[model samples]
Target: MTVANGSEPKDNGGVTPPGDVTPSETPDNRPSMSDLAAGYAGKAGLQRNSAGHVDMLKSAGGVQGIAESILPGLVFLVVFTFSRDLGPSLIAALAAAAIFTVVRLVQRRPLTQAVAGVVGVGISAWLANTTGKAEDFYVLGFFTNIAYIAALVVSIAIKWPVAGLLFGFVRNEGLDWRKDPERLRAYKLGTWIVVAVLALRLVVQVPLYFMGEAGLTALATTRLLMGAPLYILGLWVAWLVTKPAAQPSKPSSSAD
Candidate 1:
């Protein structure tokens, strides 16, 4: 028997196809993790463009968000450069973050970026204060990047790239994408790009930190330069790599 959409009708004993199950029946037809994953993957496979993925990236934080992210660090660096004092520098950074948060609140903008900026500044300041060294302010960032790089590497080593899983989760794209060799390859490449950026930050800043050459000013500068800017590039690279695979497959032409 043919279904209304021209597909063959199922021969099950009165059991409907999953999609045909009514919303009211969801409780009785609760999908398994594998089913959910398949649905997510199927959606991505059906997409005709990369717009959804782009929107997901924008929602996380766009260029303006990135600017907001680095503002507190920039303020700290400038203040420390002149005073060479940890206390004042910490206050300045925190104050800047507070002001940014207030501005965002006033504008009714998303608080995710502002809140995160403030938290990061607070952590760095606390580290510097506890350690009694101005250079220690950068410690949090260095280790954070190391952890990220390690996680990405391990995810890839396990044959499940962290970047891909995140992208899928964010976009509601399921594990089905992994079944496609091309899409999977694109995800792997994207993961590598992110790893490269994180590694670059550590490679440049770690030496300076240990050698005492970074000081407060140079370390701040390095952190600012490597922070949101490099991350944005990585985001772009991921988007670019996955764009092709996200495009819908073109219909094959019949013989003329």
Candidate 2:
């Protein structure tokens, strides 16, 4: 047997030379899960098999993505169930939803963003009045209006990193609370107006709760004080709902 350098091999039990084999490459050489985990480990400066938690943010949104994930529907469920007596003001919710839908169409936003923004705000507003505190009602509405957007952005950032950037666009640009300056302020005033109306409704509800006409029905309907299970649940969720995401640690350059 004879071996040659950098030459094609001849038949008859001959050995091929060095550089005789050509490597085939294709675009479909996708990375394996181990490769991806390894890549993230390298990027994050993690040690092999270290006792490190899986970074969901790197896996998902980082922060804002987690917020957007659960907020919209939670706000919706809270408002729709508690504020069922809004009656005509229900149109406010509907109109906001329709107009926001059109805004999405004009801006060519994701269908879900538009839907969530409008409907979520409306429902959140309705639930804002459900709080027993009259003075804080509008203030709560104004703030909660923005919460779901924040939440949606957070959730998307976590569950789907790619889609999360879009969430930021809608929150920052669509809401325009910061740059526009007046948008959040306008929401404040609008909240006040709606709250005033709700306040009036509460006054009227007083008679119903006090057994003016219907005794048992009115008693069941009124939730002015915060001792009830539903009210307590609302306050609990509200408290737990808006906490910030845990911050990831940065790599230290110096030795310990």
Candidate 3:
């Protein structure tokens, strides 16, 4: 047997030489799951910026996203108030959503928010018109809140807060944030905030829904009051909670 560098033999009978070995050639050299997990951390960090508000808006589709979200309901309310006609009110709301979608497409912005807005308005209008009850227009929102509450609770139960996953994913922090106790706690807190917002929506709107026609206007008001503004507030708090912890300074070296 011949040795290289006065160490182990380069080849012994059937054994392959060290120089021919590569990471992919051996099972021990295979990349671990942790390595894959860490690889995305840098990318997540790059996407997340210092301005949490802007990032939140970006996730929703920016200032235009806000407009798209609110305008449909606003238009429906205003038109319904003046016309006192369900068909016309629904039409106006749909038109407003369509306009937002068009504007988003023309401006080359993301269509996810715009499309969602249009669909939500369409469903709400369909429910109200089909059921011959104006209050049904807000029914979709009630179900949506319930769904959100369930989802948030489920995510927390699984030890993965939706707020943390979403914010970390956007910030390029990936699942690495979960490894930090402080960051994980922040994410849990943030997830609860979202749960609270959804719960509040259900609490306020459900009663109004059962009130019949008299509650229609009140339902609309409550929807507006607790809609985007409350969600944004929760998002902001989550961002604050997830902020990176300050690193401890290294101990100063003693002079010899």
Candidate 4:
């Protein structure tokens, strides 16, 4: 027994391993699909929570979320407000919205995020179809107006957010979204365009409001609150306009 005990014990039975975690009893406290999706929808103002901090549209800050959700729509609003007819304005808006949608697709952004833009377009269209005369539509327009104002305020307050989002998408396209030297000259042009359109909107509104054509005035001031077809058109156009190049002009050589 003393000689046999000199060697170490060997040939023991194999041990079994633990099984994979199942959905019913997973140890990790990760969120489920609905919870994760709700978080994302909250970011874009597509959905809100019960206490409402979870959903942007439901939250006090949701209007900005909506505005940030669709950049081209705001730009389209600027364009539409100045146009003579709701029909053309709606067309233009739709054009711009379409482009924004395409850019999202090309960039491979989240599918749900892209669809949220579609929801805005639908609302715009319903308003256009009902026209400003409908009481319910006017109510909707009131809220939409609030959304625009809120967005405008947010864009100004957090000015870089929009540009950052844009350049982020552009960078994905393999183009350097940011300019070297970062001059504001290019952005100035868009600013001027918005100013001119805003003035035009005001100019048109004066006569329409005075003439007693309330719908026309609403069309001018609110940019066809009920005109969805035009919204789609505008979205398409915005996509087409394309961002101006970020490159600065190079100095010519004096050797010539």
What is the clash tally of candidate 4?
Answer: 33
lDDT (0 to 1) per candidate:
0.66, 0.35, 0.70, 0.38
Ranking by lDDT: 3, 1, 4, 2
By lDDT, who's the top model here? 3
Q: Compared with the true structure, what per-residue lDDT tens digits does model 4 show for residues 25-85?
A: 3235443332222223234322223432122233322333234344444544455456645
Report the C-alpha lDDT of model 3 over 1-256, residue by residue, as the tens digit. Answer: 1223222223221222223333344366553332233323222221234543325555444567677878888888888888889999999999999998888789897676678888999999999999988888889988888887998899888878877656664444646777787888888888898898889889888999999878878888888878767777777777777667777999999999
- TM for candidate 4 is 0.32
Cα lDDT, model 2, residue 219: 26
| Residue pair clashes in candidate 1 | 40-174, 41-174
2 versus 3: better TM-score goes to: 3
- The C-alpha stretches of model 3 lying farther than 4 A from their native spots are 1-47, 50-54, 169-173, 180-182
129-162, model 1: which lDDT tens digit per residue? 9988777777888878888888888878876775
Write candidate 2's Cα lDDT for 61-114 as tens digits. Answer: 223333343333333334545664434334444554566567557867556645
The clash count for each model shown is 2, 23, 5, 33
